[model samples]
Target: MARQPTSGHEGEAPQKLRTSRQVYDQIRWDPRLDPAAFVIGYETRESGAEEIGLPRFDPEGDIPWHRIRYIRQGTTTVWDRRSRVDLLEGKRSAPAPSAQCGLDARPVHRSALALIPPREAWAPIEAIRQAHDRHVERWMPHINLLYGFLPEAAFAEARGAIAAALRDVAPFEVTLDDVRRFQHRAGATVWLHPRSEPPGALEALQARLEALFPRCSEQSTVSAGGFTPHLSIAQLRGEDGEDGEALVAEWRRMLPITFQARAIHLLSRRGDEAFAIRHAVPLGEPSPEGGDR
Candidate 1:
């Protein structure tokens, strides 16, 4: 018996299998390298009817996954997805690159209240952060006490309200004694987890802030769960496999650094602009008994 061949249409020509390859050059930053940095690239394809010429180095209009041989970030090959495919139906058009990763030249201003770590504790963490991506250094290590898209008009009122709410709270010590990993769909973040005895000061401060700024707490990602105090050390792409785990382990070994939280900072940024300290609200003075109450 003769076996019949499968066909989607009776008169259609057989789809020819082809190999497509593209190389993006001069890439300044790879998303895999720094989740914070913008994703940018150019592409060129080989063995296609569209055009066979010099490689295109223009900013990527879309991500040509089916045709991309590999994507290079800095001097590293960050991604590779290439395979043989039928080209008779023509190659699939690449979907437009996401606007989320696009670089915005204009600053977008915003404001928030946070507790930034002192330089003594931040220098080592900053080193690890920059090792992952130099750009991560732009953001200081901090625990957000309250953050939201606050307009300039409301900034003064918010700062005053926060100061009044925290006025009764005395300075306290926060011990970052362990390294933890915060996994997310976008990427994994290495963090310095703060530990304290029962009736934790960090939790207490967060509770007071939430009570004072219910709207901000409602809009926050960290507010859902009981407040977790931690400082971001580095952002990493999980695709890096053991490298990411190894980095987390290295940081874990450097546990137990303590610092006093003397003041809470009111930080602001315009739109996507870099954050700047707008006000520093000092905690209550220590009692005459030689200790904070």
Candidate 2:
């Protein structure tokens, strides 16, 4: 008989079959764009004005309000970021409560102490909400996205440092003086302006926060530079026109509105949900003698 054909495995140096290890062995972690990173920052709440045809998504109900931050982008994020942002606030047929972006009295004291005069603090929360309502009405949900990401440790430190810095300069009394406008990447926005001398308190806080969390720098997607810290009252979805200008002018005439700057809040936006309050850092503690500066 012809020599039995040798089994392919017999004497052949074992042919190395493709292995899972070989496939993933040299994969590199590219840091150019970290789509997997977690984002954290402050954002105002939205007043779900109209229910029209949109599904009712409750910002307060769906998302946690404090110590908030979530994955803004990446396949791994809990929900699709852009999709959630676009969802209308409520359903028209259902008439879900149209909640505005605002802080209730309870949260105000906890977040910022002696910073805003009680009356001053209360008024703007509503004022901002009204302004936001107008914008939303005209633009059908004018959402302003003020977002950034920080490593978890960096976030904790930065938030703490900023809070401490605010407390340090509390005596100066930063005031939110007027409404102003700026062109942002997403669109034009109307924000509250804080007028303070030496800008010392804000500056100090900025420096410290930046030193701790450099990832949110001006160059990053979550930029701190040119970020005039103001609660955004309204956002223009499209280009501003004479009509828009007229509308804004009408709003401007209504202004010269004022509020005391109390504290900076940390906010977060996950997948399809509107932004929620994460944590509120109190600016200063009032002592029996007066207020600690």
List per-candidate RMSD values in Å.
15.1, 16.8
- Superposed model 1: Cα runs more than 4 Å off: 1-109, 133-138, 197-199, 218-224, 271-273, 285-293
Looking at model 1, report the run of 10 residues with the lowest lDDT sum: 52-61
Tens-digit lDDT track of model 1 for 161-180: 66667668888888888887
Backbone clash count, each prediction separately = 7, 12
Give the top-scoring candidate (lDDT): 1
Residues 1-293, candidate 2: write the lDDT tens digits. Answer: 11122336667663332221111111111123342242322233443211110011112322333313222232332222222221111212332221222211011101111122334354534554565544322211111212233322233444555565555645345555666776643346666666665566555555455554443333123233444455456667555557667766665565554444455455444454443445446556432222222
Highest-scoring model, TM-score: 1
lDDT of 2: 0.37
TM-score of 2: 0.43
Q: Residue 137 in model 2: shift from native, Å?
A: 13
